[model samples]
Target: MTNAPFVVMKAVAKRWNGQLGVEDISLDIDEGSFVALLGPSGCGKSTSLRLLAGLEIPDEGQILIDGRDVTTSAASDRNLSMVFQSYALFPHLSVAENVIFGLKVRRVPRAERAKKMKRALQITGLEGLEHRKPGELSGGQRQRVALARAIVAGQRLCLMDEPLSNLDAKLRNSVRKDIKKLQRDLGITVIYVTHDQTEAMSMADKVVLMKDGRIQQVGTPDDLYNRPANTFVAEFVGAPPMALIQSSVLGGFDASLTLGLRAEHVSIVSKGEGQLSCTVSEAEFLGSETLIGLSHEGTVGLSVLQPGLALLDEGTTVDIAFDAANLHKFNQEGDRMSEV
Candidate 1:
């Protein structure tokens, strides 16, 4: 892998009907790295992907691939492959045909196309189903066909836009692992777009989180989870999300500040032994851990992820405490305050 970034977006901005699709966006993607563009709908993740693919030209920025400006390049000229949410496979074509479609269009020799098709099929685990049509295959298989097509293109960069959104939960998990493994095996640079944080955290080396047309944070999954740059990142990055409580509830912090704590970080302690007290509002049994939802003096709702089945009934009072070192403090503007 190269030491320099394989893809670069400098001051990229896109506008649609006087509204910003993505504003002042700049990102560097290292060669052979997996980067996820993550956020909810309309947050510009898809827009950014399109810009990189040359489907959408930026209003004010330069896009360079391998140190050459491709801002005005055509999608085909960019030499990148894209896999979309819909699978985008031709219903009339067989899996093998679909996988080799790009090579055929480029007038590659039949022998070369056949070799690449077989290699892509084997890598994507679609080896035996080459003769099947998209309509005859399961959702996961069809997705693999799409992936095989991208792989057969032999591009150094691959772009994915919510490619697993159509799969069932079980299939999504299976295919997610396959995609990550395939990227690693191929050593291709990948820019994946997804609203699912779990996918971003589990697959990508770096996560670029976006909100309302701008980047909210860019870092490793651990960095976003353990040291969020602000309240939005703190709330959005975690599962069960982070519980934020007003500083007044704890007494010693600034009144205008909020304290953030992960559900896993807060433990239930004996009454009077903890820093704060709460009444159990709900208890959810999730096999490996029990999620105890609590209401603290009508001010904030907090969740405690206690290991195993430690069922605390509703209305039962419990004391909860977290390590002071693990607390995340955010000021009135929702920006994180530096550690004291």
Candidate 2:
């Protein structure tokens, strides 16, 4: 509960077989904040999580927890809990037994273990499932057990690595809320690693985006979406992902470079000054809204967000418009330029 960062990685680097895994990553995670490490597969998000957990040692730099150096400390000495993608529960052990396995290994008395187990089960909404083994529980239930175990570990930090990946879409959405609520209620500092941008944006207090084993951007969800630091971040955080088009293809000047805009930021407008004209390539009505795709003469496509049933037939010529205030510009190297 101090102003000092609860977890710190100073100039961290990791290499494997002459390949760079992660390079010069320095981060500060505050106490009680939920931070997500987001990246595509093999982008070093999971590796970074393991380094912070003390399960893998960094080749360079230091790892500090609560102002104490734990760079080379044993994973047990770090006093942290980890919830994996797999529940990793024992097949024969009951939920209650699995939840308190760590405490049992540490020689905690049965009376105290029972108290801790009860509290953990209550927090995770699995109070009556204690008697059931992993084989007897549903996917969601098993995941909850994993979360409950982390809670009962009574650690200062919790590291969750794609804990929701195995669940179905519906189950993932529900359990995501449950986990976020649980974390907020407990006021614990958590580091979450996930390849799902939706999960990252919806749950994390701060989102740390990585690419090619390097840090890209770190900000709140809204900040990451509304003001992406670079083209990689702008393209990575959105649902169908942000659209990046060459400005020249859209009839803008040669100085225009690359234009970045979210799907919803685009629209169909009257053919006039400042409008980019194209032909309707395709359209998909998704309940309350419609997605209209436009393709220019040279095959440059732009996505337009239109309201319900405002459908346009394919091959219809249309003028594409976007809010000038919302457009982001990027150079050839993908560095962010001022909004044009």
Q: Pick the candidate with the highest lDDT.
A: 1
Q: Can you write out model 2's per-residue Cα lDDT over 1-340, one digit (the tens) per residue?
A: 6489999999999999879899989999999999999999999999999898887899999999999999999888898999999999999899999999999999999999999999999999998899999999999999999999999899879999999999999999999999999899999989999999999999999999999889999899998898888888987888656777777765644554777778887767777743677878898898888888877643333678887887889999887777767767777787787653
Task: Give the clashing pairs for model 2.
Answer: none
Q: Candidate 2: where are CA atoms >4 Å away?
A: 250-256, 271-274, 297-301, 338-340
Candidate 1, 173-269: lDDT as tens digits: 9999999999999999999999999999999999999999999989999999999989899888887888888888888877999888888888888
TM-score of predicted structure 1? 0.97
Go through the candidates in order and give the C-alpha RMSD of each one to the true structure. Answer: 1.5, 2.1
Q: Estimate each model's TM-score.
A: 0.97, 0.94
**Clashing pairs in model 1?**
none
Question: What are the clash counts of all predictions, listed in order?
Answer: 0, 0
